[model samples]
Target: MASNGLLRECVQQLKSSKHDYEKVLGGSVEVVWQSVSSAIERHLRLKKGVGVPGLGKFSFIRDFQPLTPVFLLNDRFISSYGVSWKRPPPSLVIPIAELNMSVLGSEAGLPKDQVAQTLDAVCAFVGGRLQKGSASGRIPVGNVGFFQCEGKNLQFVFDPSFVKSLVQSSNDAKPNVKPAADPIKPTVQPNSVANRTSIAMTDAIGSISQLSLSRLVNEEPDSSSDKSSDQKNDKRDHHRHHKHKHRHSKSTPHLPLSTQSDTQTSTSTQSQQILPRFLMLDPLRAPPRHLTSDSKYARVQDSAYERETEDVKNRVARSAHEVEEIARRTKAAQLRYLQTKAEKSVLEREMNAFLHGQMEFKRNAKQQEDARRSSAMEYDAVKILPRDPIVTAAQRREVKLKLRRRLNDQVALKDDLAKQKRAVDQAESAYFLSKLQLHAAHEQEERAERQRIEREALVAGWTQQLAVRAQHEQLHPTRKHR
Candidate 1:
């Protein structure tokens, strides 16, 4: 297998790919890469797949699988680039400092400590994967290949079948392929951006025009004008009628006597009289025009009286219901209390009876036992004494030895208990000491953290002041000389 380029070269290539997202992200190549790499790491941690545009997807697998990022190439990209893998994977070991420098672009802009931390995290993840895979003797590296442990050494086993299948499937799934260009087609110079934009605008206008023409062909003739004309004609006739009425009125006599008395009376009656005969009855009359006027004052008063009576009735009903509920609840509580009292009395009576019976039984048994003992003592007194008694010194000696051994064992047990007490005391003291140490350590850590924060703030303020001083010097360089 050919030797692969260093990580530096890889980072350079990545930076070159910055054109892919430069306009969209509006960030430098280093920033974009950092964001992308962090996102990839985050996705891997969550066991989700991360996709790099125009490149491939990196996925994480669960279970006994190797903790490696799986790179699945895009079919179109693979075909365009004519990508192929070597049989043996090349070594990718690089110093943490170098990798951090490459990734961050500048040490002055980004802290080395932060870079080092990030590099450590990445290395830890990779090492974890290596360890997990080494356990199973096989670690899969997505579409590229896999690593297998052979004895003490690890070796890469390349397999291009999976990648090839992915490409084939993608090619099959893609639709609407344009016709292939001629093999010997003449090369055309690329147009300027402005010219291309203008051409696109012209095409868009032409398509819009064609669409409008098609709509015009399909649309029915508009009848809006005819309706508008009729409306105008009606308006004109209305205006003329209004003008004629105004002139006629001015020409007519104004005297009430000039009008017919019968017509005037008929209009007055019609305006004053109710429309429905039923409405003439007070109970069935239409609602009064003025609720508080003299004409409807009696009705309003009656309504108020009725409302008051209803309110009184509702109050009485509510009070009665509330009284009944309270009485019912009180009665129920009293009944429950009586029932419980009765049960308690019954239980107490039964308990007293049981106790009395038990005491009588015990007294009788005790008397019977005393009588049996007296009978046995009388029988023993009447029995004849043994002719001879055997004496054994060994039995007496054994009894004394057993008693002495028991005493010695008791003494040893007490001594052992005292030792245990001393051990417990020592353990308690040690525990107290440890607790004090832990508390002191915690306090020290907190103080250190606070001091570090204060230091960082002070440093930031100093840097800002320095920056301001530099700016002032730049703006007023000749002031000192003057």
Candidate 2:
């Protein structure tokens, strides 16, 4: 089930209880559920498991086969079989109603309502801590494990010691029962007595079959030779019967020797070809003694060993391929990085050149502006100076016209310089804005590139870990026996 469904159930339960949680939890049932769910999600993103005093521990377990996260009830929860202390398989569904809140509250010396309120308070506290920690970018690690957030998702890596402790606890909780013996040996032991026995049996069977076939092929039709062969076969049969009787007597001392011999004779008379003694014994009634040390058994062992060896080889080859792929990607990333760096350098140089040119243009404009101001001051002084008494009216009028024309030219030049200055100011502002935008874009690209690199590195690390685990399993395969 999804977490939302679980939260909905909690909300329904709270509403059915008809408690005024608004005062204690500061919300109605739906709001409280939302707050609790949000708190749980945030906490789980930062820790392995979140525990409630009167409720079960909530955890997310990554299934080995699927490698997908499964919601789990880690404590104070029972499986479908109603076994409370057993370590159940990871599951999505949980029986929330099975929790004995009253008993738990009594054990804690608090009322049920208070216990519920306490749970709410805990959720609030965790939410507050997470918000504070996220703002500071320094989330504290939990005892079992911690989470690393990547964008909107969280990646969890469990501690080895914590996993070991969980394993130990599960083992301790299991009932002590002796393991049953395997009917067939799953592993091969080349130097074992069972292997030697199987080898000898195979050789004997081959030799016996070859001798029987050769005798049938090379038979003579002469009456004297036939009689002689019959006599020899009779003697051989008697000797085999005696040997079988002796062995059975030694194996089954409870049975009388006479009865064993009579049964062996009856079996011998019924079959033309004598089967192996192991074939006569019922597999279900007796332990397989020689049956387990036969050619078929040896073949099974050999095939299992071959398969295991092949699997190991395949894993090693896969690991090598992954490493090569990672290396190739790393090289490609380095090339891209170098190219980006070169482009960035070129852009910086161009920007610097543009800014330098703008500064020079502004400096030349200023110098022209100063020269214009100085010429205006000189014209003002000329206008203010006293006139000569001997000068004629026509000369004075011509001089006045010349002065007015010069002043008009100076005013127009000053207006043009002001317009040029305003245009330069606008250009400078645009250039700075573009530069800021380019810088922001570059930073965003770099961040994206960094996140990609980190993701690749994490994948490579996981691949390496899998390879190491495969190698470790190959080296210590006997651990599985334990």
Candidate 3:
């Protein structure tokens, strides 16, 4: 399979010139990559052909069973970069000693000990493989290429194409262009199906010939042995003939004349019998009838055989043509499927990108809306509240002090009112008490005066009664005594 290194290189180049690419395509980095890759796959897989700007046209070649991709150099590209086989420096030939010194220098700006250690590691890896018989391992270095073991020796295989561009600019040492008159040596042809097929055919023919020679050698001994056995049987038959005849004559002596005559005829016929032989047994005699002459019938048979052979060949050719046609159609369909797949992938990527953008936009819009609502709520709250004059810290402090003083004054006034109310209640209670005391005293004095008056009246009455009683005493003395 051809490496995709060229494609990667092209992509890198496109990336380097992305400013112009984006401007022209009106897309971002990812979009450009998707579009370019999609287009390449479509043309190369389905159409079976695609062209690159600074490279060449690429296509699929169906020379044998499985198809392969190939790049047909454009005339411009060919002129700019002529092809030639390239050979990379051998692994064991690394001039690390020289490189290490320069690398260790301060101008290289690399850690000397670390670089030395890395060099030691590389050399060890290479030397170790060499000791282990063919030095077979990979020596990879990113996209640059790698050293690998090919056979007894190590070789490096470059990425993308194995061929190097020989073409150089006219300004670059004038290119040392030579005229066409100079004889050019042709390079070795690559191993391909044609060469393999020819080699296989030669090997088959050689094997067939060897098999035929062995068969002939093996059959020669069998034929000679059979001939010697036949000769021995003939000799044994000659010796037994006379003895068998005598015995047969003794046994059949009483036979009838008709039976005897029939027996005689049978014996004669048996005596005349000869052994069968191969056609080529007597080379001196004329060949078999078929080989000796050709008849009309033979001619007809030959023509029929020829016709059969021709018919077989035609059938084989037709079958092959049909197979080729079917393969062609299948390849075309495969290409179409590839194109459709690429287009679908590109569209899906675009759709995903678009959806992501939409989601991001919606999220941003929601955030903005939330922020606006918050701001509006704050504004509304401010509008509903009463606004006070703005004051500095000192002014606010002074206002607070004034407010405290006013509160203190109001509290004092309330305390005075409460005290006055308590004093008025106490005075009312004292006056009520005093009034009740005075009334009690006055009543007591009045009662005493009444008692005295009653007593005086009683005494006066007693006096008056006493004077009257004295006048009557003389007269009542006698009665009182009585």
Candidate 4:
């Protein structure tokens, strides 16, 4: 009854039935009471649907009664129109259990045993003021919701006049504002972009083909072949001459020292460019497999082969990191598993100890309960007498709290008093932090007004300790109670 749907429905019902609500709620007490009785009865008999207009549809189910002639359950099927919903039962609809349990958990620090006890206590506490959840009333645990008992529950009543007023208000509100007349615009026109890009790509492909055709027409194949033949004949003549001249020695005979130096510089420049590219390409592809060492034109290939080597190294590092993260996840999971196992073992041991403790508790409780039960049975068999004793015994505890308004006398008198046997105790504001001082002051005040209460509470404890001390004295005068 204190759920979102129920409270909202109750509010809407009250607002709709506002005119008749006062009359119905303020009628004779007898009439109102009779209406409640009749509503419960009518609710019990209903088999078909009955509308509560703004609230919901309700019906009843018949069941056998053990203690009475019949039992009728108040069943309401309230169709709540929203974006989406299912018709809920009253008990299922209420958030009372969750709200109270959550409240208990926060208040009591979520202890296991007393958590349920706190929840039950909180619910019982709420049950007292729930019927009072009217528009303006409040309750002890009002964080759950406000409770006001003044208004009627107008659950079954609905007025048709309110709906008409709502329609009329909607009609009257139309002419105050006008709708916008402009059309929304898009930034990029897809058709125009597609048409322009298609024409540009076609023109680029035609231009590439035309440029290639023009280069082929401008190039002369016969002249390139004649030049290649002449260079090969010149290379053969030079090699033959070098072979004849260098036959007498291991080193080739140089035409001049300057010519040898110029040849060495050209070879070194080519080697310098080729070695770095080889170092880069080796990691990406085993370049020796796909490339021939004799190919003198290897440097003319694409630069991506070199970049691929670095890319592969990056991929390897990334993969190593991923593998390490996976291993870390595995380690964390195993640690959690071992921790859970240890906790489970401890819980099992604690559970056994708790069961043993409960047995001892139950045994003591059983003996106490048996004594009370036997006393109750005996009292039922005869009349019991009440006693109020004439004697009043009290032990007085006198605690004097001394406050020195003047500290000057002590320091001044100390000049001569230090020559005496002993000096007065020295104290400072450090004494203000003593919990014992606060406790003593509190105990003194409590002891003054509630001496009888304190005596009643501590008499058994005092008697037990005192008897032990007396026995200790009897054994040895010099012995202290340990």
Model 4: per-residue Cα lDDT over 1-482, one tens digit each: 22233333333443455576323322222222223233333432322223321222333222211111111112221111111112222211111111233333344344333444422332232232233333223221111112232232212221234234433544565676556423332122235543345344444434323322122222233565567568768978888646554557756464344346434544543543322444322222433433443333244332343454354445545544554565568668966876786677567546755765687699889999888877844656576689976543331211111224245566668766775523233333446557678989999988886987777779978999999988978989665545
Q: What are the models' TM-scores?
A: 0.19, 0.22, 0.26, 0.19
**lDDT ranking from best candidate downward:** 2, 1, 3, 4
Cα lDDT tens digits, model 2, 1-482, are: 11233233334544555566534433343443333444444444443455544324556443232222223332222211112222334233222222344654555555667657756553333334333343111121333343333232223344556556555654565587468535432332457554455455454444334322222222224576457658768978888646555544546555445445445644543543324344332323533344443447445544554554455456545544554565568668966876786677567546755765687699899999888887844655454558777989999999999999999999999999999999999999999999999999999999999999999999999999999999988999999568
Model 3, 1-482: lDDT tens digits are: 32333223333544555476323222232233233334444443342455534333444443321333444333343222222212221111111111223323243343454334333333333444343444445544233234453323444443443112111211244567455431332111236443344445444434323322112112223465566557758967878655545556666766555446446644643543221233112323433344322545435434554554455456545544554565568668977876786677567546755765687699899999888887844655454657898879999899999999999999999999999999999999999999999999999999999999999999999999999999998777877787
Q: How far out, in Å, is residue 365 in model 4?
A: 5.3
**Index of the highest-TM-score prediction:** 3
lDDT of each: 0.48, 0.50, 0.47, 0.40
Model 4 vs. true fold: TM: 0.19
Candidate 1 regions with alpha-carbon error over 4 angstroms: 1-295, 375-384, 387-482
